[model samples]
Target: MFYWILKYLVVGPVLKAIFRPWIVGAKNVPKTGAAILASNHLSVMDSIFLPLMIERPMSFLAKSEYFTGKGPKGWATKWFMKGTGQIPIDRSGGSASEAALNTALQVIGRGDLLGIYPEGTRSPDGRLYKGRTGIARMALVAKVPVIPVVMVDTDTMLPIGSSRPRLVRVGMVLGEPLDFSRYEGFEDDRFVLRSVTDEIMVALQRMGGQAYVDDYASKFRKQAEESGAAPTSAFS
Candidate 1:
């Protein structure tokens, strides 16, 4: 109810009118059934922007802190997430990965779209990073097609710690769904999984026109902090 209202009546309408994004390859998204949207994480808005473009509802596994904050702000955050049907996954601790995978599997079993950033966290620099094998493991286990989505210009719209997203036109480009059924039962092999993940990232690079970087997003953030430089946006 709240989700629908927000999607149709409030946020969705305003966003569409404002950004006026040029969405390409939207036809790639399946009309129905289970599918994985493997995307590059560039900004906080990346999560919200992609879902609004697609007609189907996608459940994004957001960081748990959004649901566990304190005070009035926390209450509002919790309400927004719950109302919009987004689940919070604790990205810290030893069991974080397991918990996220479990939640994602449940969503897939229900034949819904699951949004995942192959890069574990938001990219500190615009360059594409090596994706975690967890995505491959989940896709094979869930037996769902993984669609590579490219969110162009979102990194500049709302960067990390940017009190609010700027008024910028960001686009979403969806690529053909990549199936991982062939790699089924090979989740235990780290080498194979990393190779598969890299292949997926390559597809994303071609679609989004982003530079390829082997390092993870978090690593770049640390580098930026060390150099006293701001994080790079995916503008070019």
Candidate 2:
């Protein structure tokens, strides 16, 4: 379908030829069944390059704004995101978080791979940020394994606010699948959720080699905005 055509025929080949992305531990991804690919979000291209390198088609819970933009560039962005197998979910918290969790569960319910950025948003700096507990909840509820993925140097290729990507090699590392079956029946426990989320973030930091930041990335970005500090790009 559109995903196949875009991944293999249209956009995939072009990206492969240009960026020449290298991957390690791709065999860690399960060949079948439901699993969550939790990654550290460094740049927007983290979504694109990870899915491109993996064999199985993965779906990401992308923000709804990507699907509702106006004008030609917006149209192209919307088309590309859809064509690449991204599902739009409102990131606004409260009931919206529940809806997104349900949508993510539905993806795994179909025995498909669901990509999630546990950090919730792209890192304002190159350091790994605290992960949101939603991913932990989803994994516990879905009763599936969670694999830690790390996208290398993606921010350098396409930093925030950059309109075009640089021609550079990027890489991905997939860690072994993490089993949280011990806490299977405790999905509703907030303490357990935080513990699970912290465990996953530790794995990512270990694999990705990024300095760990205990605070949330979104909070850091918001604080910077409120203090009149200009957002700093990864390259900057």
Candidate 3:
């Protein structure tokens, strides 16, 4: 009820009127059944705009911090996230990572749309990064197709560290769903996971037209932080 209210009555109408977001290949999203919406993370607004444009409600595994803030602003943030159908998950790897994956599987099990950023984090420089294999694993395990959704110019609308957003037009392009049924039983194989992830990334690159980086976004950011330099990537 809250989700619909926010999307239709409250926040959605305001955002739609302001940004004037557009979408292409919206028909690629299935009207029913479980599937993964794999998107390239360019800005935080990617989460807001993607779901706003889609008719069906979608859920994303948001970092735990979003739900665990202090004060009135924190309370409102938590409320908004919950109202928008986001589930909080700890990003810490190892057992926590496995737990988060399990949570994702449950969402898929319910035959719902689960949005995932395969890059694991937002791109620091707007280039497409190598995807984490977790998305591939989820598709294989859930036996569902993965739809590649690419956000265009979201970074320009709201850059990485900017609080104020520019009144710029943004859009998303949804590609035909990529099926991994051929690797149904190979989910445990790391090589197969990498192969599947790479294949999805390739599709995103073709659709979004972003430079492809062979390295992981998280690793690239860490290196940049250590070296005290701006994030840079050599297209592969």
Model 3 TM-score on a 0 to 1 scale:
0.95
Off by over 4 Å in 1: 226-228, 231-236
- Provide TM-scores for the models: 0.91, 0.96, 0.95
Candidate 3: what lDDT? 0.90
lDDT digits (tens) for residues 184-214 of candidate 2: 8999999999999999999999997899989
What is the lDDT, from 0 to 100, of the residue 154 in candidate 1? 89
Clash count of each predicted structure: 0, 0, 0
Candidate order (TM-score): 2, 3, 1
lDDT of 3 by residue, 1-236 (tens): 99999999999999999989999989999999999999999887888899999999999988888888889878987898899999999888999889989999999999899999999988988899999999999999999999999999988987755667899999999999999999989999999999999999999999889999999999987876578665332111
Query: What pairs collide in candidate 3?
Result: none
Any runs in candidate 2 off by more than 4 Å, and if so which? 231-236
**Candidate 2 worst ten-residue window by lDDT:** 227-236
lDDT of 1: 0.83
For model 3, state the Cα shift of residue 102 in Å: 0.9
